[model samples]
Target chain A: MTDRPLDPAVLTPDQARALFRAGLSVPTAGWCAGRTQANLIAVPREHAYDFLLFAQRNPKPCPVLDVTEPGAVSTRVFAGDLRTDLPAYVVYEHGEPVAEVADATEYWRDDLVAFLIGCSFTFENALLGAGVPVRHIEQGRNVPMYRTSRPCRRAGAIGGPLVVSMRPIPAEQVADAVRVTARYPSVHGAPVHVGDPSELGIADLDAPDFGDPVDVRLGEVPVFWACGVTPQAAVMASRPKFAIGHAPGHMAITDARDCDYIVP
Target chain B: MTDRPLDPAVLTPDQARALFRAGLSVPTAGWCAGRTQANLIAVPREHAYDFLLFAQRNPKPCPVLDVTEPGAVSTRVFAGDLRTDLPAYVVYEHGEPVAEVADATEYWRDDLVAFLIGCSFTFENALLGAGVPVRHIEQGRNVPMYRTSRPCRRAGAIGGPLVVSMRPIPAEQVADAVRVTARYPSVHGAPVHVGDPSELGIADLDAPDFGDPVDVRLGEVPVFWACGVTPQAAVMASRPKFAIGHAPGHMAITDARDCDYIVP
Candidate 1:
């Protein structure tokens, strides 16, 4: 079957989800322009409480937008089927990636609880709107994410180092970026660290634990925000028997708007 | 044993908790002046996920501060023992109030999960600091709280109408009150309804579902904020088999400062 001619940036959230449901696989960065995109994670019921508590304790890295009831597929924010609508899925077993599949239906469980976490994409758009340059997007690369020395508060069996994503902001625009992004607390909020990466024990900016690296110009400063990968890091460390996540850069387009999460 | 002479308003949080733990029972409104006071709710592990989901869905009425592990009695926010640290406790049997006691150690269960929710006491101080008169405090009465017509989003078995606490603010200072309180989102940030009582389906201004009613003067407008009583209302409506909460007005004093919750 041939894919439809579509401009992801102009498509409505429902249209994007429909396209994804029809098996068109693509990263969701520019999709459904004004809507919020979410990172997905599904874990068995036995581990749901721990994961929820972990997210509660480490809210910066896990700003949960919505959590589906055990075994349920849809939520108020995401009207599409959880098992098949996302462009890509990563299935984990005992903390290790066992498969990357286009459809998660066969891996889905009756007792699974899904969490839709806020992504930095929302804040990046806000940053750009506020005239703050986003290095990764400008370079046409992924944001660089690093595992930090600081450990998140542990909840039950879930515990791991905090992870952060970095962006090089022009010296004068640093404050503007912070003010703009701080408005979206659900989407990682303000920068976790500014100026130095060593403070977070991130020794090298060029070698990120995940995502691609970007150049930091002489007049720019590297600012870091809490990354959504922290929860996945905890899942890896704690080794839950089963877990499912959207592949990096592939997000669940939700019905909620970017402005829905903005604080006054 | 003779009670020690102390000004409740001047005591530190640790001191306040010690006083309560030593069997002194009093409302915590004036205690721990700069620190945050939290509402307590403990339920069986079987019902924890639903309660957490409920809090997540209805953040305005149920701003969660900290949640303890099942069977645990302490958190980073509240270092004191949960079962005995509060000034008063109310035990619930099938959502009906079964007992109100000074100490809850006798009824505490090993499988209970405790949730510490943000209370309006924090924002009330901010309002007073912002030159907004809180009539209930001046009259030495409990802040009036009402059950509203609006229903909170349901999560699993936990769902109920939104509950709001009213304060009479002079029309001129309404904006100031909103700006000051909005800074503290964890404590039910900003007013949910302003001006008309009929809008919220609150039939009488003098009668409230909880707390004592305060007089709304001619130039003063009634401003309603999402109340901490909401989760308890849900508990009563859902009728869980067993639950425990701090008796109304009595609270668990936590280590976090009220300023720690304020946003830019």
Candidate 2:
């Protein structure tokens, strides 16, 4: 497969799902603009109860949009099979990643239950529209995510530190960004922390635990929002016997509109 | 046990829970007025996924505050044990009510998961404070609830007609009641239907599926809000081998304040 991504900017949800179904693996950052995209997580039916409980306890980091019946193919959020609808899938066995596949057909199992969790794409659009500049978007890079010291409420075997994505904003627009994103609770809600990275036990802004590091210019303060990856981190920490997730950036596109999810 | 309910107006949470725990199996209405009250539903671990899914699918009718760890006695919402803290419990075997007991300690099992679902009591206070008189309160009777033709979003085995509580709102103040109660989404949010009872397939305002019927006076309209009892109705419809629920009007009081759950 070529390294080039098909221009997903103009594709509709149906078209995008079809494209991904054909085994294209690419970041979904700019695809289906104005629509809600989701981070996908799949776990065995036995472990699903714990994962759902974990999401409920830590809603900000794991806003559950839709959950599928065990081994069920389609979800209400997206009318596509979980196994073949994603651009890329990361298979984890006993909490360790074994392969990154375009289609998870080979890894699919009867007891696997898939979950569509809210992603930050919706809020990020709100931020951009509100004129709150996202530094990573400006640099055309993945958002810098950090492993925060703040621990999420534990549920059964799944428990870990809250992971957050940092976006540097002009000090003046910090309140606007918070207010804009706060309207969409299903999509990571509001900034979990602002100003000091040290408060979250994050040492240097240039060094992130995941994703590419973006520079924080003078007069700009770093703002952190709960990331959807927190659930993945929990799954890894717990060392689940079997797990499946969308490769970072290769998210599942949903038919839901971003405006519909806005809480008043 | 006596038929008389304690004068709950002055009792604290701890005192109220203790009263109920000591075998005072009376209706919890008007007791623990300031704190939040919840409808209790307990199901075996094997069927917990469906119950949780049912709540997520029909959040308006089942605003879940907390779910206990399977076979765990206490919950985050209320510190009291699920087995013996409640004054009234309706035990079900294969979906049929087998008995109503003051204490369910004998039926307790390591596999039972109790759910704390939000009730409309919090919003009722808001409605009264907003000067929207609740007719049932005026009549000193239980709120009138009906089984509506409207069906809830089904999840797995749980599917049933929505059950709603009707409050007679003066024609002039129906909108005000909605606005006031709309502020609390954790409760039933806003009115699902206003004015005509026939629209919801409710045959008569005087006949309710549950609770005592309150009269709809000449200039007043029947307002329907999704009731927490809808989940219980669903549970009964699914007919799991074992289930436990609080008898109607007997609720569990929690430490949370009504103001804290206000979305805005």
Candidate 3:
């Protein structure tokens, strides 16, 4: 067996699929550098409308890239085979994580529809290239995420509190951060709240509901952007009978480039 | 009773509602200048997901501005009471136009949801302001719309051929027409096709599927953009038990400005 790390530059979207098919890479984030990667979530067809409506209501946190037809695995917008393209998958039953697997071919059902949602990694690269520091990346830690007091707009059976990711920015560089990220609205565009964590019901800076807590020094303010995890939280709260999503950091990489999502 | 024509410039979104409430303006198009005017459609709650998915599938034609809570009359994003704010509404039953009512108050149900979609009039004004002559406006007729051979991708039970509106532009001005309209993606951004009508299965310029046909003069090519009427066509073809939409030329004016829809 070849033990070399997968080179994203050398792989095609199809080759990436082959790698995932072989159980090579477990997390899909750093695998395909320039291509768009999506956060995948599959739910039973009975709850498809409710999940879709939930995504629409909370667009900032869940900008839907494409939703596949019921019982169909291929999506027209995001090119890739949903069954084997992703390197990892997480199956949830009654909102609780049951298993982590490489391929969902066995768990897949005829009544399941997949949803591809925009991921912040696409825009984060843009920010880094533009000289904006992504603190979590610099510290080699997962971005801190918190459950906010602010509730997402309810739609049918889907309703829950908003989940936000926090990044500390120097006072002088705050505007630059906003300008860089604002261009990609499809990936949780612009910061929802800039200054106060207290306003979001996050009392202690060190304690986060998910991910690692980063340092916020003297001159930095805790800037918050809606996180992709909001939908997962909503799904968990709604407690749908069956759902599947990417394991925390793993995602489905698409043929689309990050620049394609930029507005103007 | 005062018989003065409604002056959009002087009215607030609430005042406009009061005026519409008092039966002062039957057609909402010219009443609220500068504010975003929307295409209103109400569907039974059971059919809400299909219609919403249809809108998502055909966004250029059905650019959704906001969707109201189920059974709720007021829109959280657009503003005011949907029941009496609109000057007029057309009720359709079993795919046929049943009544043109001044108010949907009586027909309003606890299981219905209102959807506000982007209207092309928002961008038409910008085009005219930029010196692009709109043919139908000059001739005092409705803008010409045609049914195309191109089919929209299906979602749930909604699927049908695309419908587009044609505006004749001088060959030299096509680029300017594109740049100006492309700024407003929410309101059918950019042209779907240009130059040849026959390519879209349009046989004669004189006959159109909906609205009046306009003349295309020498050195001008008919530019086509997805029309807001596409959803209505799908609804009719699908034959939902009941549906409601604004009468053509009549729209729902909102608190949002035309510039608000522009991404740049």
Best model number under DockQ: 1
lDDT leader:
1
| Candidate 3: stretches off by over 4 Å | A1-6, A78-84, A105-107, A135-143, A166-173, A203-208, A212-222, B1-6, B15-30, B78-84, B104-110, B128-142, B168-173, B203-208, B212-221
Cα lDDT of model 2 by residue, B147-253, tens digit? 88899988888788898989888999998988888777768888889888898999987878778888888998888899888877886777888989987767888
| Predicted complexes: DockQ each | 0.63, 0.44, 0.41
Candidate 1 wrongly placed segments (more than 4 Å): A1-7, B1-7
lDDT of 3 by residue, A1-264 (tens): 225364654566777777777876454444566777788889997888778878877888888888888888878756667877787787888888788788888888889988888877777778778787778867756678899999998777777889898889888888988888787877787889999899999998799887788899889988998877787777777778888887655678887888988875
**What's the true lDDT of residue A128 in model 3?**
78
lDDT digits (tens) for residues A119-144 of candidate 2: 88777777888998977767877778
Ranking by DockQ: 1, 2, 3
For candidate 3, lDDT tens digit of each residue in B7-33?
565676777777777775444434556
Ranking by lDDT: 1, 2, 3
lDDT string for model 1 (B1-264, tens) is 227446677888888888888888876775778899998999999999899989999988888899998899998899999988898998999999899988899999999999999998897777778788978878877788899999999988888899898999999999999898888887899899998998999999899988788899999999999988888888888999999998877889999999988875
Interface C-alpha root-mean-square deviation, candidates in order: 1.1, 1.6, 1.9
Which of candidates 1 and 3 reaches a greater DockQ?
1
Off by over 4 Å in 2: A1-10, B1-10
| CAPRI grade, predicted model 1 | medium
- Candidate 3 is scored at a TM of 0.86
Weakest 10 consecutive residues of candidate 2 chain A by summed lDDT = A1-10
